[model samples]
Target: MPKVIDHDQRRKEVVDVTWQLIVEGGIEAATMREIASRAGFANGALKHYFSGKDQIIKGAYERSLNNLGDRLAAHTAGKRGIEALEMFMRFTLPIDQEDATAARVLLSFWERCAFSPEIHGGYDEHLDSWKAGYLQYLAEGRADGDVLTPTPDEQLVDEIIMLNIGATVVRVVSPDHLNAHVLEAQVTDFIARLRRAE
Candidate 1:
């Protein structure tokens, strides 16, 4: 019998290799030839799994988003109101090496998004999911009397999202300036300010 191949597994392996390349050297480093070689596949083998480099990059980007989502779920499980929101925000930050690696890969995709409609669409989808989650948590906090901010939930979501993105960039680009401890303190203060005053 001819050798059997696990297409999905091969595709995932290709994406993983590509992700590492991008993380180490930005998106430019994830060339098709390099990915295939790194993945132990013959030249042009990637075409079987992805249309081209763009799709592979998209796969890596989606994987990063999925990883973060899983982390968020685990961190926020059984939590509610301010607690859930804090966990959500904290996990979103690049406070640890793993989170920072994901952030760096995401930043690479952000640059591609300006030129790739598919990547831009994926980015928008991820942002929408995050916004929905933020609104849900904010509503829950309001119901539980944990949040007393007069600001509209939408506005607060925007601020929180901006802060997360900005902080991720700063953390990745200037770790010494915004180290993990500083990030944790900043998030704590931000969340505390959202709660009702005693």
Candidate 2:
């Protein structure tokens, strides 16, 4: 019998290789030929799994977002009020090697979003999810009397999103300037300012 191939596994492997290339040399480095070589696929084999480079990039981007979402869910599970919000914000920061790696993959795709409506739409969807979660935790904190800030939940959500996105970019570009300690301290202080007096 001819050899049987697991298409799903091969596609995932291709995406993983693409992610590594992007992290190493930005999106430009993840060329189809290079990805196929790194992924142990023939030059044209990637077409079997992905339509082209954009599709592979989209796959890698989606995978990165999915992984981040999973981590956020795990870290915030059973936590509520300020605790949940803090965990959500901190995890979005590139405070560690893993987070930093994810940031690299995400940032590589950030530019492409401007040129691709599909990718841009996907990003918006994930961002909306993040905003909703922030709003939920903020409302919960208010109900529990943990949050005392006069700022509207929607405004706070926007601030938090901007803060995290800015921090992530800074951390990726200048890790020395925004070291893990500094990033953590910034997030802690931001959350602290919104908490009610004990």
Candidate 3:
């Protein structure tokens, strides 16, 4: 008998391929043919898993969100409050090449949103989930009295999120132009202001 493929696994395989195609070749190079070729599948094989390109792209967007969420969960395991916040930030900011590729693919997904409402909606949901989790983290830190900064500025924390995203984008576009050491210091200091006396 022919090998039976796991449907969900195959779907993710297609999305994983979609991610690589976009990352290595940019949006234009992510045509269906390219994805299939790069994925080492026959032409139109992706269709068995996805109805269209947007379907797969949306899946990849969710995968990316889950990817970050998983990393943050692992990084912040057994931690809480200010430490949790720092761990979250550390998982987000580009400290190495592997992290940078994930960051870069994410930015590319944002640009893809401009052209597809499906993608835009998917991206928005993922971002809102992240932001909501962020708000909760801040609120919990404050309640725990472990929040180090002067109380907490909700707007400022949101700005910090933006700063993180913007900085990572720069690293993606101009790898040589970005200094991880500088970014690390800036981010660490920013989080430092949020700590309470131990």
Candidate 4:
């Protein structure tokens, strides 16, 4: 019998290789052939799991988002409101490697969207999903009195989401060049503004 490798594991392995390539040599290094070579798989192996560059791009986007989502879900378990809010914020930090990798790859994919409308839509959906996580934290805070802001105007939430993502790009690619702590504090300040009055 041929090797019975678990498809999911191989997919994760390829993605993990692609993630490293992106961080080390930019997204261009993640070209199918390069990624396949780095992963020790045939040039076409990626196709078995993805349709083409666009699909891999979308899969990378999904993979990166899931990395954060899975962590946020774990952090929020059995927690509520600000507690969950704090945990969610921590996952966005660049202090951790997987989080950093996810952030870097995500921004790379965002840039890729400029060339492909399909990836553009996928990127938007991925972003919206993240915003939903933040919204969940904000809504939970609102219900628990931790969010004192007046229903958090849509623009503000959008700004927060954009700002965090922007900062993530900076922190991921150039840690020595940017301070993750400053961005974290910026987010914390916003969250604090949402807390109930004394």
Count of backbone clashes, every candidate in sequence = 0, 0, 3, 1
lDDT string for model 3 (118-189, tens) is: 678776776677677667777778788756566446774687679778877888888887777887887777
**Cα lDDT of model 1 overall?**
0.88
Instruction: Tell me the TM-score of model 3.
Output: 0.86
lDDT by residue for model 2 (29-79), tens = 998889999999877988889887878898999888889889988999999
Evaluate model 1: give its TM-score. 0.95
What TM-score does each of the candidates earn? 0.95, 0.94, 0.86, 0.82
Best by lDDT: 1
Off by over 4 Å in 3: 1-3, 148-152, 196-198
Give per-residue CA lDDT, model 4, range 1-198, as digits (tens).
888888888887777777778777768888888888987888677788766777666666777777777777887899887787677666766646666767778778878889998789876776687678677777777787667776554655687677777677777667776665676677677677677453
Pairs of residues at least 3 apart in sequence or in different chains that clash in candidate 1: none
Superior by TM-score: candidate 3 or candidate 4: 3
TM-score of 4: 0.82
Q: List per-prediction Cα lDDT, in the order shown.
A: 0.88, 0.87, 0.76, 0.73
Worst 10-residue lDDT window for candidate 4 reads 148-157
* Deviation of model 2 at 138, angstroms: 0.5
Per-residue lDDT of model 1, residues 1-198, tens digit only: 999999999999998999999889988898888999999999987888899778999999989988988988899999988889999998998989999899888888888899999679978988998899999999999999989878888998998889888887786677788888988998888787788454
Pitting candidate 2 against candidate 4, the one with the higher TM-score is 2
